[model samples]
Target: MFLVESKGGAIACMLFSLLFLGTWPAVLAFLERRGRLPQHTYLDYSITNLLAAVIIALTLGQMGDDKPGMPNFITQLYQDNWPSVLFAMVGGVVLSIGNLSTQYAWALVGLSVVEVVSASITVVIGTTLNYFLDDKINKAYILFPGVACFLIAVILGSLVHSSNASDNKKKLSHLSSGYEDKVVYISLLFLSWNKGASKDPENGKEVKVPAQFGTAEYLIELEDKRSIKVFDRSIWLGLAITFFSGICFSLFSPAFNLATNDQFHLLKKGVPHLVVYTAFFYFSVCCFVVAIVLNITFLYHPILNLPKSSIKAYIADSKGRGWALLAGLLCGFGNGLQFMGGQAAGYAAADAVQALPLVSTFWAVLLFGEYRKSSRRTYILLVSMLLMFVVAVAFLERRGRLPQHTYLDYSITNLLAAVIIALTLGQMGDAKPGMPNFLTQLHQDNWPCVLFAMVGGVVLSIGNLSTQYAWALVGLSVVEVVGSSITVVIGTTLNYFLDDKINKADNLFPGVACFLIAVILGSLVHSSNASDNKKKLSYLSSGFEDKAGKIAFDSNKGASVDPEKGRQTKEVAQFGTAEYLIELENKRSIKVLDKGIWLGLTITFFSGICFSMFSPAFNLATNDQFHLLQKGIPHLMVYTAFFYFSACCFVVAIVLNIIFLYYPILNLPKSSFKAYLADSEGRGWALLAGFLCGFGNGLQFMGGQAAGYAAADAVQALPLVSTFWAILLFGEYRKSSRRTYVLLVSMLLMFIVAVGILMASSGHRK
Candidate 1:
């Protein structure tokens, strides 16, 4: 009978299997992403997978077996039976075909459908094949039931995936709707129908409408407008391919098993080789050869999605190459672990690895924004699937003598480790003799300013969010220049009006003008320097591929085209490839910013106004109207204000993050418990930054309490502090030309002039 041999072996197999199952999703996702990018094609997938197989083989070949006296992999493989090697080669060929088919299917059907089909079928087929291939088993009942349960789990997980994908699509649709006004929406739909002949909604009859018509026609068009959803043929074909791809994938393990099975004597006797390593070597060789041959054929009849120059262009992208390389490494490691587990245990153990749909499902829901707005039914199904996997894995790996360990055990341990590390680091940092620690400061009775600061913090956070959204829609340089100017002017105006202690022209206008001028000049210099860099890069680079496989120039910023749309552009290619590439990149960048320019600018202006009120709000609360609570020690007001501000920032950040997790109105990243734990590792640095910011806020408020809001804020016009630090400490401007240097220096000079003007314009105390 086939046995686990020992508890250690079973545990090792389980760990390796999980590793194998978990990694495939990540690796494949990376490959698919690279292939789908503007310049990449299916050939990238072929190359990376081949490379991964080769790397795995070589690495595995170098390692000795568990037995001390066993020969190294090179000797073992060389001595292994030829038929065994042949079986492995067949397995590799099957694997290559299945993987290619799966990729094609993914492109055709969406990610949701493809993942579900392949995963469910592969789990069932692979497990069945492996079980039948090997007769040895200590507990057949436990194994079979476990496989069945795991299959159910896979199906349930697919349902969850489908539900999540549907939700995300709906969310995206809502976002698009939000972007369009009623007029724009009606106009776009009118134009769309007119682009091609469509049936009239009123009579269900064919009609050809003109693009620009009279008001009566526009009214008629709006009345006839109804929702129409067109289904693509490719989606059905993709589903079909994906279904068969799973079956093909299932054959790979059985073939490998036949090659490596010593107990069954499927191969020639007396072959003294490590089964996993030897099989991998042969499989890798076959995979490498097959991928090259297929890729060559693909060159003549390229895939539907890929551009003609995709092969060359993909190779030119350095960032893409890095992703490809990392993916290959991960895939290799994962595959190797799977084989090791299968060889050590049995097909049942390997099949149990299919329980990885649980991991994939978890990540999809938690990280990839799956099921955020899914129905209660979706969650129930997902939980049920998880339970099934739990029961399956538990039964499959159960041995009466062994201690049962769950994922919770590992999670708790990891969490404890993180907490302990954070506390230890915090204690060590607290040992430094400079400032009062965060806890001590927080606990001290500084209530009034604290309340004021907290309220101000919320306003600042909202403004920051608006500014971020503005940046994405508007160009960076404009937002920075305009936002800074608005902040200075509005803050100064508010202070002057509210305090009634400042002269309008002398205290606010001239200072605002100087600050605005400085901001404008500084922004211009920065943008110009960046433009110059782009120019230099365009001129010098001959469009050769770099070591990382990216084109030497910035394709996103300059002249790169979406290969699919511009595939036939021999004219552009004839032009210096460098010029053509830079042009394409420039067009892409322009299109993105231009689309939402107006809305983004409007939001940015509002954000700037909101940001300006922050200091004034605190000033009013601590020193003016709400100063009844400030009767105690003056230092307490500053400290109390800071405490409240910090508390507000913390609370606001947490609440907003939680809200985004479900609705994602801003489409921001969702915060999760896992992420929180991960952030704990860097808690020491985070705490330090927070402490510095709080101390700075307290001091700023203290200055305001003494000097009035106008003067306190005017001093902040010293952008030169940041500029000097960036230059002197980080050597940021070392590569800039003399002209760039002059502009930067001039900007700094203006900042100094503005700060001096504003500080001099400080209002008198009431």
Candidate 2:
């Protein structure tokens, strides 16, 4: 009654299979993030994957002597069919490209969507290919339908939870920023049309247009076409890449199986383990070679070869080196396990393992913070999708072993069940009236919050843009460090230097130091290796809230309408606003440094210095020695300053959106201006967000006026306010891994200490 043949064994294998495969994809995500940072490239990924395969091959190569008839794994590989090895290598090349594209998909779409799509594709293709090609396990009836059902579920799930466009803004924003220098060729006819409109005479009765019968209407039509093309291209590119990657994933197992099958004489019929290890080795070699060629070609033919300095910088980047090595090991080992598992447990066990999208979806939600607070329809869709995967595994494993029922009968039954479930879920999830769209949530009440946010946006726009420009001039890490330090030190000093002479608390500097240290630690946590208790860990967090201070915190819960929950008023009680949380998450990650970082740092340092001046500038406009704004506006000083700032933010947002419409950085779709204006689903929320943001900004200014800017900013480090809300209201940290909890607690404690220091430093009250 081994686990492979027994029901219990199958279950155990499925769970273990998730560990062997589910978590490894996340490492690739980390590598992709490195691609976005300084001194990293696909070459690094290639090198790392090769190294991991080598390590595993070498390790497994040591073990084949256990079998009496076999030579070592390496010897067997050379002794096997040369064509088989070559084909395996070719398969590896396809896989490597696919793997790279998988990361790209993750970056472009998200973990959950890509996981479902790719896993579904792999199951269908791999199951069918291996079943017919390999003698390892044979069950066409159960396998085909199960895989089909899985595919259907994936489609339904995708439709249910369409890409959260707003959620992806941060990741996609960089594309626009990176491509800021790239130019788009536009038709001159539109320009001519605009010019004619501008030059219309006072009589305005007759402005002759071109003989082609062009007019304002024609311009509008042409503009719409251009916007739709850009928008559609971005969407199509992402979908195409995702599809290609899925097909590539499907080929890996079949290729490896073909390489090692003794019947095919693809490789030597050595010890089973030795064969598996050899297959991996051949695959890695191919991956490495292909990666090198592709990357080199990219640098040379497509884009001019990067300067030697950039290449050197990439090579010299030691920071991501460790992560890359770790990723390679995980990936190589994971593949090896799949091969071994296929050999040991049979096709049922292997197919069950292939159904890993469930595990991936769980991790995507918990670790990456996706799908939180999604609509009920999304929840149902996700559940339905998971159930379909379960059905797929159930039938896929019973393939050749059915005693009473025919394969066709089981397949039809399973297909029907999947269709019924998917339909039920889809019908259940119809977009109800009150769905959270985020674009149309504006209300009269939200205006104040929107106003507040716009004010904050205005107050911070110059500093923010300067920060972005500085990153291009220098690099991100340097700018962050310099900006953070200056914002703390200079802003605090200016607040203290104010004419009111506010009492200074003693913990100001210490608090700032502690928070900065914490920020560094939190960055490390994201990049840190997981603890050894990896198998026992569920990828999902337990969605439970601590009730200790629930009653006390409940009072602060604003009667805000829940976007995901529909138009119903829901309590969103928390100290931190959404803006604060977004900003906090955005600023958390820290990258490894390179030579380019120095220039970026220098620019960032100057920018940071300028950033320090903004808070003081607001302070001055409100109530200063010059009273340049305060005296004139008197009671409306705060409002006037905020009004100006909001206007700035509005202008910048509009200009940026307009620019993106023509030249999309992230390759996102561009809608016509009419479409944008017509879409009013979440305007209330937008205004509310803006208003709340403004309040936060005004409060910052007021706090700086009362305490030193250093003290006020130090208090900003107490991000736990938002964390608590994310937990209680959003159930964010439920049942997370111990390491995750440790990271969370560490971040929380650091922020607390920083806050304590800031609080202690704010000596006397106003």
Candidate 3:
């Protein structure tokens, strides 16, 4: 009986400790993100004291009649399961990468209602994915609440500070300063994905909260009257609500555990069925509780009220919008796994110790590293989809005859979750003070950070390559730990080494050293690559040995030849010992394994081009619009401002499409005569992409040339419409599910409606 009672409690408490431990790092970061946790001090003492309290309570519960009965779980001294142990540790490491909150706030809610509207878009994405995958869902989710969430995210993303009649439009302060209204939305919008983690522990655990930071913002203001601060009552309220909700969700986890058990398993036929009693009463209450909170915290939303003219003006000035969007997506990817996984685990634990995982965002964040967070959403979605697919695989381990619709169900769930996770991760990346543009330019100003970042990226690449190799030989944990170690080392290096003084001279050493040290590092990287190739060879040999009579793998040494009856064995190892050693056994780890390295290079190169082009355009538009009091036509400033705003959105999209098409470094054009057409296969398509932009630009330039400044939009519209059509015609986007496609079409319809209102009002001429 004692052993039975203690079975799940220990796991539950460990999870609770994570959330409890997590809040400290967060608050510590909230206070001074740069500094390490103070050691051997009062803060440390407090943490220790809290940890003791929880352990004591758990200890007492586990003890038998004044003595602990060896605490039900036999803490194995890593006895027989070394591989599983390694995997678990790696899982913990990957989960620890998430950590951006401040920057995400601005992307969510700008100064204007339009930006507030844009911020609301994530919710649309989140809810859309949820609607499809969630077993218990409603119609209102799609038509009513779903549309509302998207409109809000968009309005928020688009909202920007407008210049007053007598002044130039100030760049809205990116960081919070004397911005109450916007900050309110920032905190709230941030809460949309990052509701943080659970504040309290579960039934079997004790939580140590930090002095209940309730309304601390107000208290701080009262304590220091002279201080004009970003944290105030509203911010405090938002924080309190966020943390409190975490507590509520924590309570839901154990209940869900019971529900999961009940859902999957069949109980015995007895007088009082164990499952009937346990599930019926508890599940109903849990559902009701979840429903209430979901509606109040997530579903219930503010009404949108965009001025018809402002919406039109936004359409006109959609120039700088691409960065904002890409930023939003990256931020979403970073956030989704941390926030959604946190919230889900909180509810899934059903008031047990497992609920503690939510406290520490790092655990979840690390799994979706900052770099991965910043990559293209499609890749992020693909990674997420792969993970969900793994989960579906685990689901297959259930002790029963599988259901008929198992594959379909798993596929849909994986796709939906992947979409939601991507959107969330993208949001987190866009929210941060991203890798400074100066760093990747290989410039003097940010060279230190950039240099270290690139080195870190290299380390990451090596680790990923190693991980793929390791996974083939071992399991998932190999990649997880090695990859985690690389990130930690790089992030720490960046934090400590990167400063203002790094210059061309400092960087020159590395550039020169790289050449001098090429053999050593190259030996390391290339050697690993070669060894992996060798291992891949040997893996094939082993396969050939085991299936000696059954199959043949003679490929004439790297020559592609299809043998009879084994046509689909392109992934087969060749007829050699080296071939059998490195054949791809763990396909999942290696599938998108090179994503980190590839994206690092892509982001580095593509961002430079995108920024260089867009910056000049943005500057031109800003100068043309704001300086128009004396320059062009009388009301040109007003007309130009709106055009530039709309350009922001469109330009970002165009840049993304361009980047997607030109991702592989080899795909870039060759400059000289011989090289020019040498890269034709790559350049030909690039030319078409460029031509699409050229045609769009030509129409835009011509419209501005022919029509008076105010009416030039008719010409600009040609590019946007064409671009939209091009996206449809090109098979660039994934084949979306019918439901998702429909939802997107509906969004398009709403955008058209919004565009119509804007175009009609454009004729009014402000």
Candidate 4:
């Protein structure tokens, strides 16, 4: 049977397993949150989960020439390996139960906390057992410390959940009477008081309203829609189930370890230990069987007071079946990879993936909105929990390999990561010795091409600078849509001609037209949203003026108020509704003028023009289609051009930013170089962002050189990604008019179609 004998191959399997396993939980949770019945989801998931194992066994387990001792999957099925098979089955049974329990726990304790508790328990208990089972193949000193980190994460996770639950309870208690009647009015309040009340001017008495999601309204909606009713449920039940699931999770890995290695020598002396594939097949088979029986039974006799369902009901439920099946596939493949890695590097080391709460927390925040506007204490604990998992994974991963590396080894790690990803996706092949050839060409003569590369960098820097102001003026969604559409329309056309029509014009020009349509729709959406914001601001301003006048009249009549109460009212009033918009405006570096829309559109147009020119200039530098080079001088290579381009971009950014620091414009506060250096907030994040951008550009240019720059301009669909973030991160378009929402979605759809068409237009350079 095929085997992963090398440490590197095993580590690769482990890393992929971590990603896949970490993501499946989020998918399942997503379905549950959307009100899909757990029984139906689980039943659907079981089919694909078992199918994954069968596919793996048929492919990887039958690929290599089978030896006498290491029989292939089919051969092993008929052999006397029942003892090991039973052990594998037991592991699968426990895992199925553990997963089933966690589904309910997610609704109770929250996705992020449930994952943290369960994964920590798995690592702490499972790793300890696997270390002894695997004969201490993994380093105890490193592995034990990583386990300790998981334990800390468990404590912090519990604390975060407890604190957040308290915050929710407090918010619910303070909810105003008759809030249900005024639901529409209450919804308009932006950041409102979570723990107290504001004065009602008419009655001269305190009144309260819901601000964020953990309110009575939200809970009632969830109870009405969700299969697992959390209404009036005790948090202790969820915590108890979480602990039980963790214990179940802890035993499965060690059971699988014994099944593969026969650590207890349960088999006969002559019987070969089951291979990873055969053992995994038996494990998944039992898992599937257990899941089927339990989920089917639950359909007839549901738990947690969930609504009764039957086989007919499950068969009829097709709303989220595709997502459930996908989750199963992801989990099955993830488990297979984990086992393969464990067989090579010891099951104890493979337990490192139990730190997957890091991935779970990311999805919980991004997809589920788990921690939006959470308390400071909860955020702190959550951050600490994630950091501990990171350290734990690092220690466990380090334990799997022998330590030996030079400076060059450390330096090339990032480059190697990029190359590995490209190779995996079939975007790259065997490397060529192009660096020396480019160096030789540089010595001969390429001064004019170097100038072309530098000019591209200069324009790119200006474009980047202009975007900061444009975002404040035109908004993130509109700016990205307009800018990216302009890039594709102008840049793609330019590259098509420069590359000698290598790209199919028929397909390319249609994509450009789609982008043009998107631009128009985007402008309409922006104008509609602006009008909505103006109405909100006008109402807010008039209301505040009326309240101030009332307070002054009361003061003149010798009325008095508590100083603390006045301060509390001021604090609460600063959030929610038009106050949110005012706060955002206050925080921005560039102040928006009354005529800023026109100015913003001008800057956006200029930025798009600059962005469109950079790629064509780089194309000229690499391809030299304009023949701006001396005789016998070769054109600049992709890497050489990128180097000069990024260098000039960096230099220009540094000079311009320093100038802006001392002499700021557009009503931005002025600061000196010393002040910039002393500012420490978000410095690490800024540096990381710069590195990612540079790496992305480098990859884009490399791919462009290989294929054609016109097709490479497909990356101009930046609005698709930016719009997703704008909706999630900044709450853009939330509670906007229906017409605005339609325009927004239509603009995104056009961009998607445009991107696909542009990619389809790619043609071979030769």
The number of the candidate with the highest lDDT is 4
lDDT of 1 by residue, 286-363 (tens): 865776667656655566534354355546755555554554455555666677667666765565555555545443
- Model 2, span 187-294: residue lDDT tens: 434544555553457766646354122232332333233211221124445556777888998887777767666446544454342366676788889888877776
Error of 4 at 537 (Å): 67
Residue 688, model 1, lDDT: 27
Name the TM-score of candidate 4: 0.53
C-alpha lDDT score of every prediction, in listed order = 0.54, 0.51, 0.27, 0.76
State the TM-score for model 3.
0.23
TM-score versus the correct structure, for each prediction? 0.44, 0.41, 0.23, 0.53
Q: Which parts of model 4 have CA positions greater than 4 angstroms off?
A: 176-223, 397-766
Of the candidates numbered 1 and 2, which has the greater TM-score value? 1
**Best candidate per TM-score, number?**
4
lDDT of 3 by residue, 376-437 (tens): 44243333322222221121121111111121122222233223323333234322232222
Off by over 4 Å in 1: 1-10, 13-17, 27-60, 63-70, 105-117, 150-235, 262-269, 304-306, 375-391, 397-766
Q: Write the number of the candidate with greater lDDT, choosing between 1 and 2.
A: 1
- Model 3 has an lDDT value of 0.27
